[model samples]
Target chain A: MLPLCISHGDLVKLFVIALLATTALAVASLFVGVSEISFFALLSGESNEKMLLVLGESRIPRTAALILAGAGMAVAGTIMQLLSRNRFVEPSTAGTVESASLGMLAVLLLAPDLPVMMKMLVAALFALAGTALFLGILRRVPLRSPVLVPLVGLMLGGVINACTTFFAYRYDLMQAMGAWTSGDFSAVLRGRYEVLWLALALTAAAYFAADRFTVAGMGKDFSTNLGLDYRKVVALGLLIVSMVTASVVVTAGILPFIGLIVPNLVSMAMGDRLRHTLPWVALSGAVLVLLCDTIGRVINAPYEIPVGSMLGIIGSIFFLSMLLRRRSRAA
Target chain B: MIEFSGVTKVYGSTTVVDDVTAQLPKGGITSIIGPNGAGKSTLLSMIARLIPCDRGTVLVDGLDVARTSGETLARRLSILRQDNHMTARLTVHDLVAFGRYPYSRGRITADDQAHIGRALGYLGLNDLGDRFLDELSGGQRQRAFVAMVLCQDTDYMLFDEPLNNLDIRHAVGMMKLLGNAARDFGKTVVVVLHDVNFASCYSNHIIVMRDGKLFLQGSPREIIRSETLEQTYGCPFEVQELGGNRIAVYYT
Candidate 1:
C-alpha cells in the first residue's frame, strides 16, 4: 500500500480544487437546456423577460436541487458507511430510497391533498423505519465477509421495490410511481424544490458531527473507551441518512450511486477522517450530478433523458469496477 | 485500587468467568495468566466496563464501574483489547490523538498535543506518526496502540494480550515499557499474558485462573514453583532460578 496520509495543507488545497470544479460545473449546468439562455444576453441587461423567467423558474432551481441533493446524498452515504462499518453499504442499496418511494406512493393514494412538506416527512419516517430494519437484519447476519453486508442490503432493496411495483400496478397509479422513482429535475420550479433545502441543513449537521462519526467508525469498543455514547451517534447517523434520502427522493426522485461512489472514492484517497474528507465528498457528488444532468440535457437536446437513468448507467459501471478491483486485489 | 466482588459472566450456559472476586493493588504491574477459555480477558473487560457483568460489582477506587458514568471511568482507567480491528484508515498520530478524547472531546488542545508527542517519542514512533496503520508492521502497530494507551494518561491501564502477534524482541520491549510506566509514572498496569515465563519475570504480582475461576493469587516467587505450575497447567514443569528470576521450563 502506498502512503495514504496527506498533510492538512494538501487536504485544504484539494478541497479548493474540488470547489472550483463544482462551481464551474454548476455554472455550465445553468446554461445547458432546451431554451436558449445565453450568458451575454443575461449580463447585457437587455431585459429579456422570458429568458429571465426560464432562468429563475427552471434553470436556477434545477441546478440548486441538483447540488443540494448531490451533496446531501453523498454525505448521507458517508455517515451510513461509517455507522455500518462497511464501505459497500449506502442509502440506495440499504432500502432507504425504495422505502421513501413507498411512502410517497402511500401519500399519493391516501391523502393526495397533503402538502409536499408533509409528504416528505412521511417519506422520511418510512425511510427511517426501513433503514432500521436493514440494520437489524445486518446484526443477525454473521459478517464474516465484507461483501455480505451490501448483498443483504441490495436484497432488501429489491424486495421493497417489488412490493412498491406491485402496489403501483394494483392501484393503477403506475405513471405517478414512475415520476416519483425516476430522478428528473426538469419539473423543478422555484417553490417545488425548497424541500431539498432541508437536505442541505442535514448535510451541514452531518459535517458538524463528523468527528463523532469517525470515532464511531472505529467500532463500539473504541467509542466506549473514548467515553462516547456509540448508540446515540449511530442513531443520529441513521436519522440523517433517512431524512436526506427521503428529501432527495421526494424532490427529484432517487439519485442512486452518489451516496455510494462519492464517499468511497474520497476515502480511498483522503483516508476516512470525515472532517477532512466530507467537504471533498460533497463537492465531488455535486460535480458528478451537475455534470451528468448537463450531459443528459445536451445529448438529446429537444427530448431530455432523466438524470436518474444517466446516473444509473454511470454508477453501475463504477460499482462493478470497484467490486472487481477489490476482488482482484484480495486474490 | 480496583476491586471486584462476585463478578460473573455467563455465555450460553457456560460460566466464562465464575464468581471472580479479587482486589488489584494500585501502583504496580499485575499480570493475569491462564490457559485458554479461562476468562482472563473477560475479567479484565468487566473491570474496564467494556462488557456488562452478569451478576457482580466492580469498583474502581470506590466508584462502581457499572454505575459510574463512562466519561468518569474513562478518565480513571483505560483498556486495550486484543483484537483492534477498525474500518477507519487513520495514521499513527491520528490514532494516538484519540486518547485525549476524554479530556478534549476530539478537539486537540495544546496539552493534548504535548501528551501525544511524548507518547509517540516514548514508543519510538516519532518518525512513524505520519504513516498509516495498515502500512506499518505488526510490531509497529502494536507499539502504536500502546502509545495511544500511554497517551490516555490514566491512573490504571488494562491490556488484553498485548503481545499477541509480536516477535520476541517486541514482546520484551512491550513488557519493559509497561514496567517503565508503572515505575516512573506510578500507574497501575494490568496485563493478560499467555506466556507464564513472561508473567513470572516482569510482573510484581501474578494472578492465575483455571476453569473460569481464580486458582491462585500471589507474587512471582510464590506462584512460580514446580508443583503449583503442574497443578495449574496439568503438565510437568521444572523451575530454575537465573539472575534472581524464577523461569519455568515445561516438558513436552
Candidate 2:
C-alpha cells in the first residue's frame, strides 16, 4: 500500500542522508570550540596556532565521539523502547546509566590498572544485570496502566542512583563518578575515543535485527506465534543497549535524555520503521547533541557548560511539553 | 489438526487450564466460549505458546509447541490477542506489511507484497491503507490488526475476543470473514468469542469452559441448546431457532 519501498536501496538512501547530516555537524563542531577556529584553520592547520591544535586534535575527536555516542545511545533507546513497548525506556531511565557508573567506579577503585576494554566489559555486564533485573520486575508487576511502567522504571533508577551515590561517597570515588555522570566531551582525544566506534557496529546490528525486535514488541504470545524467539530478541536487545551505553559512558560520560528524546521525536515525525527510524534517530541525535554542545561552548564564552547538563535541562523541558500535550489531548 | 493432550496451565497456585484434552479439526471455524475467569484466553494462549503450560502439551499439526523453534512453527500458526494497544505510529499498510517479517525478515519479497495487498483488500481496508492506525476508530483498528494476522498467511489462525469494541455490523462482518477464511482459504480458525449467537452461526464447533475446566464441547448444533447456554453462562437464557441460527435471548 505504501508503494513497496522496502528494499536495500531505501536503506541506502536513508544511510546516505544520515551520513551527510552527521558529517556536516561534525565539521561544524570543529569550529565551535573556545578559540573559534575557522574552516580554513581546520583544513590547513595554519591559522591561530592555539585554534589549529584544538581543532585538529581535541575538537575533531570530541565531535566524532559525540556523534557516535549520541547516535548509538538514541538507536539503543529506540530498540529498547520498541521491545519493551514503552516510550520512556532508555539507558538513563532504565537504571543502566547509574549501574554502569557504579561499575566504572568499582573498576576505578579495585583495578585501576585494568585495561579500558576490561573496564568497559565490567560496566557492560553491570548495565546488563541492571536491565535484566528491571525487566524481571516489570514482568512480575501487574502494570494494568501503561504509564505506571515508566514511573516504576524511574523509581528503579532513583533507587539505583541512591545506591550508586552511597558507594561513590563511601569509597571517595565521588570525583570519578562526578566526572562520568554528566557528559563532557573534553577528554575525547583520538586514542581515548576509538572504543565509541563500537556503537556504530551496534547500530548496524540493530538494523539487521530490527524485524525480530518489532515482533517481540507485539507481546509474548503474538511474537511466539509468529516464530520469533522472544527471549532471545529481548536478551540481544539488552546486550546491544548495555554495550552501547557503556561505550558511550566510558567515552563521553553519561549524556542524559538524548537517547529518550531523539527516538521519541523521530518516531512521531516518521513512523517507527526500525529500518527507517534508526537512521533518522541516529542523525537527529547527532544533530541535537552537536547543536547542544555548540551552544554550551558559546553561551558562556570562555567558560563552557557541559553538553550533558545542557541536554538534561533542554531534554527535560521538551519531555515535559510532550507529556503535557498528550495529557491535554486525552482530556 | 490442533491437539491438546492434558494441557494444564497454572498461574502461581491456581490452575487456569486443568488437564484439558481436545482435538480441533483442521479447516473449520472453531469458537471457544466461556464465562469470565474461565481461562478461555489462558487456554488459547497456551496453545499459541504465548504462555508455557505448567503441565501437558499442545501439538499443532503434531509439532510440539513448547519444543518447536519459533522460526520453524511461525509459518504454520499465528495468533492475535485481545488488546492490541501500541504507541508506535504506523499506517494500516505498515502494520500489515509486518506480517511478512516471519517469511522475509523485513526484506519483503514480491510475493510478500502481494500477500499484504490481498490481505488488506480482503479486510476492505484498501481505501484506508495509508491512514495511521491511531487515526482509525476502535472497530477499524481491530480490522487492521485482523488484516495483519491474515497477512501472516498461516494455516492455523487464532484470535482472542475478535469482536471486542466492534459495532453490530462490523462484528457480523468479522464473523463472516472468519467463516469465509475457514471455508474458502482452508484455514483452521480458532476464535475466543463472548457472543454465543455469532459463534453458533459462524463456527462449526464450540468449546465451552467454566471455572478453569472444560465444561462442554461439541458441534454448534449440539452445544447451542437452551439448558447448555444457561448452565455455561450461569444465567437464565432462552434459545430460539431464528433463521436457522440459535439466537439466545437473555434480556430478562
Candidate 3:
C-alpha cells in the first residue's frame, strides 16, 4: 500500500548482492594472511605441517569471528540509533564496549575461575548500566546539534577507558586488558570462538525489538500513545546491545568503528526501514571488517597490525571525510 | 462528550490551570480564546493527556483519559500541538502516513492508504505529497499537519494554534476545514485560537479564559460581545455585524 519498495523481489535481489559481496570478502580474508603459509602450499596441504594448522584452526575461525563480530556490532548500532533517535550512536561511540571491557577485566581480576558465561553476564550487566547512564545524561543535558551527542558519548567513553586503564595499570594487569581491548583475531581459534554465536541469537532479538524502538523514538508521549511501553522497549534495547557488546568483547576484544560506520552507510543507501536495513547493515558490516582485517594482514606482511588499530586509523579518516563533506554542504 | 472535572495543573508554586471544570459537547466546533499566559495551551494539553493534571481527571466519551491506556484514548481522540518539528527527512506523504500508525503500526494496509489519499485530497495536498516538509511554506506545513490529524480519523480532534503561520486565505481555509469536519463528519473539534474574529465567525460554542480560569462559556452570540472580548483580552475590541457573522475588530 505504501509502495512496497523493498518487496519480496527487491529483498531477494539486495540480499543476493550482499551475500555475494560478503562471500568474496570472506575468501579474501582467509587467503590473505601475514604468516609463512603461501597460498599454493596451503591449497596443496601436501608438504607443510604448520601451514595446515594455520589454515584449518587459525584462518577459518578468524574469518568466522570477523563476520560474526561485525554483524553483531552493526545490528547493535542500528538498534541503539533507533532507540536513542540519534544517528551517530554506536556501541563503541556510546561507551558500551568499553564498559563491557571494564566488566570483563573485573571478572578476570576478581573471579578468574568463573565460567565463561558468567563472565559474559557480568560484562553484559555493566554494558547495560553504562548505556542507561549515557541515555540519562543525554536527557538531562539538552544538546543543540546532533553531532554534539556523539561527541559527548565519545568523551564519556574516554572517561570510562581512562578509569579502566588506571586500574589495569595499578594491578599490573595492563597486558591482559590491553589484549582484550585491542581486538587481536589471532587467538580466535575453535575452543575460544564459540561465544560469538551468541551474537547471532542477539540479532534475532534485535529484529523483534526494532518496531518498539521505532515507536519509542517518536518521543515518550507518542510511544505511550501507540501502546508501546517506553521503559520496556528501552530496557530490551539496552539488554540486546549489552549482550552483543559482551560477546564481541569476550570473543575478539574490541572492534572499533564497525558499529558506527557500517549502519550509517546502510541507512544512507537503504533508508531507515529496520526490516530492510538490518540484513544489509549486517552483511555490509561483515564485509567491511573482513576487508579491513584482510588489509591489515596484507599491509604488514610478517607482523600483522591489530584489526582494532587498523579500523581506528582508516575508519576515523573516512568518518572525518564524511563530516567535512557534510559541513561543506551545510555551508 | 468530553468532561474535565476540576482539572488543576500546578507548576511549582504557580498554578497554570486552576480548578477548571467544563464539559465539551459532542459534534461541534468549540474554540477557546484567551490572552497570552492565560493557560489555554496548558489546559488543552491536560485534556489531551499531553500534560498530566495534578488534581483531577479528564474523560473522553466516558473513558477516563488518565486511567485508560494511551492507545485506547488515541483511537478515540487525536491532538496536534503548536510545534510539529520532525528530526527525520520526510516527505509530505511520509508525514501523513504516520497518522495510520495507531492502526497499522507503519505497515500500511489498503484501508490506511485510502485514508491517506483522501486526507491529502481533502487538504489539497495531492500535488505536494512527495515534496519534503522543509521545502513547503509555513502555511503549507501547517496544512500538512492538519491533514495528518484528519487522516487519523478520530472522533475527537484537538488543535493548539492551528493557524499560527497561515496567511489570511489559508487561515480561513483551515477554519472552514474544521467547521466542515464538525458539521459533515460528526466529529468534535476543539481549537485554541488567538484570533477572536476567526473564532466568532466559525465556532458554534465559545469559551473565554483569563488568568488560568474559564471566565465565560456560551454560544458565540453570547460570548463574542464587545465587553466580554475586552475583559478577556485586556484590549479594546468592537463587536460588529459583518455579513451575518459576529466580527470582533481589534486591529487598532
Candidate 4:
C-alpha cells in the first residue's frame, strides 16, 4: 500500500466541507451590515424590493468583492512565494502594495478624472516594477537562511512606504491615500467594485498555470530540466501577481496578510502542489476575509471597523506564531 | 553521443571550466572524477544546458543544446544537481510524476503513470511514493530524486555528485542502480563523482579533471592507476587490484 498522507477520497471530502463552510460564511456575511436586511423578509415577499436593492447595491457587491479580493490576494501571495521561493514574502511585505499605492497617487495627482480601470493598470505597472526590484535584491542576498528573505523584503517595503508617505503628506492627499490603503467594504456599492472581477480572472489564470509555478518553485535548474522556460514562467507569474494585487488594492484597498497567511495555512493541511491546493487557498482566503469582515462589523455594531485593521491585528499574530514555530522547528 | 567542443564557463574573473572538449560515449556509465573545484559539475551542467558555456557548444546526438528548444532537448537529456532544496512540499510520487511534464504538460496519462510506477519500483520506492519528501531520510530522499530522473526517461542522464550525502551502503546501491539502468535501458549515464573507488569499481569509462581542465579519459584500468590519480589529484596515492578492479587508496 502506498504511504499516503491524505488519499484522493479524503481530499475531495475535505474540499467539499470547505466549500460548504465558505458558502455558509458568505451567506452570513451578506446580512451582517449596518442596514438590517432580513433573509426571511426577502423570502416571504414583504419589503422585498428594498431588501433586494440593499442586497444588489450593497450586500451582494460587498460579499463578491470580499470573495474576489480575498481569493485573488491569496493566490497572488502563493505565486510570489513560489517565484521568490520564500514562504514569508508577500505583496504587503515585498513592496508591491506600496508601489501600487504610489501608482494610484501618481494617477490621482496627475489625472484624477481617469477611469477606474486605467488607475488599476497604472498601479499594476508600478507593482510589477516593485516586485521586480524586490526579486533583484533577493538574488544578490545569500539565501543561506530562509528567514532572511522576508526580512529583506520587509526592509524594502519600509523604504517604499516611506517614499509613498512623504509624497502623500506633501500633496495633502493623506486622507484620500488613507482611504485607499485601508480596506473597507461598507462603501462597496454597485460599479465601485467590479474591477475585482479582473482579479478573479487573474486568479483563474493562476490555476491553469499552477503546475508550472510548482516546478519553478523547485529552482531554475529543476524547471529547465523539466523542459519549462523558467524565465518566461517567472515573468508570467510576476505579471499575474502584480495585476491581482493592483485590482484588489484599487477596488478594496490593501488587504494585508491575506496573501501571506492563507497560502501558508492551506499548504500546511494540503501539500504544495498548487493544482490541488490553489482552490483551497482561494476558498480559505475568502473565508478568512469574510469572517474578519463580519467580525469587524459586529464588534463595533453600527460604527464598524475597517477590515484592514481587523486583519492586521489577526495577521500579525499569525505571522509571529509562524516565525516562532519555524524557529523552534529549526532548533 | 554527447559531445563538448571547446566548452568554457567563467564566473567573474575565475575560469571555472576552461575550454573543455570531450566526447562522452553512449550506452554506458561514464564517471567524471575530480577534486573540488575541478569543473566536473560545470562540465556536466554545460552538457545538460543547465548553464550556458561562455564559449563553444555542447551537442547531444548531434543537436546543439544551446540552439535546441528546451522541450526537445529535455526529452533527449535530463540532469539532476546536488542540493535540491525546495520550498514547496512534495510527495515522492508527485516529484517523480513531474518527470513526465515534458510530454504530458501537467496532464497525466496512463502511459505516464506506467513510467512513474516503473521508476518508483526501480528505486524501491513503491511503498513510499505517497510519503512527503521532507518526511523521508536523506538516503531515501536521494533515491526519490534519482527516481525522478529515471522517470524522465531521457536518452542521456547527468547527475552532479549523486553521492554527496549518502552512507556507504546507499552510495554503493546508487552506483549499482545507475549501472543497471545503463545496461537495461541502453541509456547514456554521465555522473560527477568525488569517490575514485566508486568510479573505478562501477564505471566502464572514467574522465579525470584537474584545475578546470580534462586531464585524462580512458577505461577505469588506465585512469585509476596510482601515477594518473596522483597527477590528477596532486596527492600521493596507491593503486590495488580488488575483484578485477583497480582501486585507488590515498590514505596517507
Candidate 3: clashing pairs of residues: none
The fnat scores of all predictions, in order, read: 0.65, 0.69, 0.19, 0.79
Q: How do the residues A266-285 of candidate 4 rate in per-residue lDDT, one tens digit apiece?
A: 77666789999899889988
Ranking by lDDT: 4, 1, 2, 3
State the displacement of the C-alpha of residue A32, model 3, in Å, after optimal TM-score superposition: 1.9
Task: Please report the candidate that would top DockQ against the real structure.
Answer: 4
What is the C-alpha lDDT profile of model 4 across B166-220, one tens digit per residue? 8888888889989988998898999999889999998989998888998999999
- Mark the 10 consecutive residues where model 1 chain A has the least summed lDDT: A1-10
Residue-wise lDDT of candidate 3 within B1-252, one digit each (tens)?
999988898888988998999999999899999999889999998888888899988999999888888777777898888876653335687678777877877788999999999999988999998776767888899899889889889999999999989999888888998999999999999999998888889998988888899999999999999998888988888998989998988888
| Structural RMSD, model 1 | 1.7
Q: What is the TM-score of chain A in candidate 4?
A: 0.96
Query: What ranking of all candidate models by TM-score puts the best one first?
Result: 4, 1, 2, 3
- The per-candidate count of clashes, in order, stands at 0, 1, 0, 0
Model 1, residue B228: C-alpha shift (Å)? 2.4
Give the top-scoring candidate (TM-score): 4
In model 1 chain B, the worst 10-residue window by lDDT is: B130-139
List, residue by residue over B80-180, the lDDT tens digit for candidate 2.
99988877777798889988878988788999999999999988999988777878999899999999999999999999999998999889888898888
